[model samples]
Target: MKKTLILLSALTLMVSCMSKEEKMKEAEADGNEAIAVKSKLIEGAGKALQEQGKAAAKSASKGVGDVIKGINSGMSESISQSDVIPEASFKANFEECKAEKIYASNDDKVKKVTIYLIAKNDFKGDLILKAFNADKKEIGRSRLKADIKKDDAQYVDFTFDERTHLLQTEYFTIK
Candidate 1:
């Protein structure tokens, strides 16, 4: 009976001592597995961020392109016309004043009509400009006060505040 008890004690001591090494090895394996999972998660997150950045850049590029197209179309819609409709007041001063150049143009969506005149007599009054469409309907009007002497050349600018976007000003009149 004493020999049996000694044998059981030795067996228990051996098992207890071996369990420490086994536990250490298992813990090391668990740590390596956790590191691998973390590395995979980081790589996946990096890939997702890269894809998101690429998509954002593509969308911004498209937005800029659309804005450029809009600007180009707006620029193409600008107008410049030299045709002028003669009125009775204009004919009465034909010998005293000569209309050299007359044109209407648009800049930044604003309409501007200009008239270059050579005066052969002394004049001091307001110059009125009336813009019209194809049907001869008055669309806009502008007035400028000016004082001029004989044999003087002057440039007059008239700006339209309303209906600035319409390029249908086929003709205009001066008074």
Candidate 2:
């Protein structure tokens, strides 16, 4: 029973490191890949228990899953680190950006566009902001803070200089 608990606990830890998309794929894949991943985790845990002399008290059972809610919250707060943009961040250029009144004043000067996202509290996934042109040209984008409220998950700030072009935007929610 101890061995069984240890094996399952270790598998949980390893699987925790995988992204949700990968997990979905694993679930959809044939049993082979699943078994391999499971086997690897079990073997690793057994080794740790032996070498660490039981000092390996970090139970896989109490890993990221136990505090998943908090861990994701922490991840959201740590989103601006350049390498961790939630997959839900992007910009799409579309039509409204050329709607006469808005575009008439838009020249060609583009200073910069920062795209990001802020996850709504309790919201399953991150919010998405996209910018599109009249021809659906992806112009620019930026996500809000990772830890933003749903009511505040919206960011459509389009900035330009004398060198930017008329850019339209389309916003969507992604979970």
Candidate 3:
């Protein structure tokens, strides 16, 4: 009977030790899985933050470029306006026709002249515009078709070639 009791006690101890070992192994496996999941989450969060930063930087760069373009445009306009000389003379070679307004428009490396005319007689012909410098030297010339009614007004635009120095004109004549 004593031998039987000892044998049963040994069997119970062995079973308990095996159960504890299995439980420990399961806990270790769960811990490893949790660590792997945490690593993936961290990596995903880092990638998301990096993408946001890139987008923000790109937007800021575009905004700065637009501002610079606006400033350059403003400066060019101011410089062009200051270069024009007021009190420029304009002569019309038609009877009872008066030169009303003359203005110079500047473009990229070129200049254009616009003339407003008022007449009391019906006229239809090709109008020749000649621009001269302060020294009376002819600098530019352009021809445009004009059709003016009696007691009415007309606007004529003369576009000169790129080589013409129309921007430095001091006087002009229309015939």
Instruction: Give the lowest summed-lDDT range of ten residues in model 3.
Output: 81-90
Q: Which pairs clash (backbone N, Cα, C closer than 3 Å) in model 3?
A: none
TM-score of 2: 0.22
Model 1: lDDT to the true structure: 0.69
**In terms of lDDT, which candidate is strongest?**
1
Q: How accurate is candidate 2 locally (lDDT)?
A: 0.44
What TM-score against the true fold does each predicted structure earn? 0.45, 0.22, 0.40
lDDT of each: 0.69, 0.44, 0.66
Give the Å shift of residue 157 in candidate 1. Answer: 0.4
Q: Candidate 1 on 8-63: residue-level lDDT in tens? A: 99998887675777989999999999999999999998899798978988999999
> Model 2, range 1-175, lDDT digits (tens) per residue?
9999999999999877888888787887857787889999999988887988454445654564669978786764343112212232222211111111133323643433443334333233333433444465555443333344443443333343433343333321222
TM-score of 3: 0.40
Better of 2 and 3 by TM-score: 3
Among these predicted structures, which one has the highest TM-score? 1
- On lDDT, the stronger of 1 and 2 is 1
